[model samples]
Target: MKRIDVTRNWQGSRLDRFVRAHIPGTPFGVIQILLRKGLIYLNGERASGAARVKGGDVVSIDIAESDEASPPPATKPKRGPGKRAVKLPAAGAAAAARKKLRPAAVIGRDIRVLHEDDDVLVLDKPAGVVVQPGNRAERGSLLDSLEEYRRRSARTRPRGGAAAADAAPETIEEPPFPYTPVHRLDRDTSGTLVVAKTRPAARALARAFARRAVHKIYLAVVEGVPAEEE
Candidate 1:
């Protein structure tokens, strides 16, 4: 096993990000696999890429000497008229284009539902899963599974309710939302995700997240104890 010590500049970055910056020739997918297989350890404990690191943390890994690769070159931003507007196809064209898209079935094994209510659904997104369809990927994503599940659930769930006969015009609203993501996570950052099942819920959840009303916490394992508390 080879060991590396984290420096002050690398503190607070994701352990995986730090590895990629320092270790060359190892792809992220490989690193994740190695982590799962007990080939990688942080401070003598098995660690996930999502682990956060601090200065003086020790990383132990199995890698070749020649794999001391350099960091990848930075990508240049695309030049366009401001930001290029994504032109969604027209209705008829949209239908035709969608016909060519992959079948809207869950390509991955399953959607791990953590919680579900009338307004929102919570899921545990696995590390390797994508939340939505990518430009080049043919596999369906978590979004596709949710869409399919919603479509089927609508057939069983009751949609009819007592209509308020005396509602004011100002209170009227648009239609209910389809399954929509409240926020996004990087493809490899496996964690809890909240999705809105209705428009009202979406707005409320978005506001809550944006305003930092929701309490957030992170767990990490450091290689060595800090000499002083900050």
Candidate 2:
């Protein structure tokens, strides 16, 4: 638990951004999770990640020191010296990779489907599920599940309904899926996630987010009361 007072010069910044500036070595994802859980406060009230802070505001951040721990090591077997290298079939290799990459198939696991349509899908993701693949080997993520869903849906759609004469030939692509997430949510913070199903939709959604047209709100619990409001 730590208490920090915001100075006049630190006003007009997002709460997460402000905290990142002051705390060195703190991951932004961790801060986001804290903000979502109400561990961060502004003027004695729970603060959202998007909450605006003015100068001279007293912000209290209640972070549990134990929750921040290094990730476990990889579980793959180590290669031994002098082992004959055998080339696997390219197609087989690709399939294996996909299987390994298939994000956790844990349906109904800490996620709530908020809205679904042809162009987009919105979900309320719970804490601890990685939104996307990372450098590590952790499987099962929101993107992976969405990619699977997309494949199933594409299979069911009627084909040859409207083909563009000059359209480029379609090709098989890898999954992390074709859909683009308009924005990201922290692994430990549960919140709404918007995913675009098509390239055009993806671009439009991304632009909307970039322009701040999308509205987001986070709820958190704080440690103490504030002396004054901003």
Candidate 3:
């Protein structure tokens, strides 16, 4: 059994959907079965799939890791010389395609923080790093880097002695989902990205975006000249 804390990123998400996002390659039917068996728990209590999860909630998933791994795709020989065609399962194929979009491993320092506060974190996202996980298991995203930075900050934070005692309690407390992208930039697009640190902030930002209250301006550079009315 594994326990996953509900972060602001997944706040207000349905239990089943939350589990689905966290546990990839697992069939939906299996999740239902687990729920029926009371193998899944929310805050140490049996929960339904339709229940909503909030930040700071603890979810316990009692599922075997083997069940999470999908069988390998089948392969067949093609008509061409020394060529073969592989048949991938629908879910597995999609997951594989998503995984292919990820770049090489990235460290926390790669992401630049433009602005940070209790409610939001703005970053200068670099080209080639994804905004979030393409798949549940895939990493090397801006979100991952933010988490890494949070972890590093926690490790370096003052501990013990009078200096530590004088530190703010909130600083020493475990952060709940340090970053949740309210908007997304393409993996190849390097630009300013806004992330929410609290669920209320996330909701407000989402509403603002939905209402088109936020304005965005983009700049592009081209090296070659275009043809003259060709």
**Every candidate's lDDT:** 0.66, 0.67, 0.70
TM-scores, all models, native as reference = 0.42, 0.45, 0.43
Best by TM-score: 2
lDDT of 3 by residue, 3-66 (tens): 9999998888889889988988666656776787788899999999999999999999876743
Clashing pairs in 3: none
lDDT string for model 1 (1-230, tens) is 78889889888888787877776755665566567676777898988888988999998887652244323443454547654322212224423433554442222355456555577676667677788777646557777777778877878886535464445344666664679988886787776677888765777678667644454445555797887533
Which consecutive 10 residues in model 1 have the weakest lDDT in total? 85-94
Q: How many backbone clashes does candidate 3 have?
A: 0
Local error of candidate 3 at residue 35 (angstroms) = 48
- TM-score between candidate 3 and the true structure: 0.43
Q: Tell me how far the alpha carbon of residue 84 in candidate 1 is from the true structure, in angstroms, after superposition.
A: 37
Q: Comparing candidate 1 with candidate 3, which one achieves the higher lDDT? A: 3
Off by more than 4 A, model 2: 1-110, 158-177, 223-230
Candidate 1 displacement at residue 42 in angstroms: 33
Lowest summed lDDT across 10 adjacent residues in model 3 is found at: 85-94
* Number of clashing pairs per prediction, in order: 1, 5, 0
lDDT of 2: 0.67
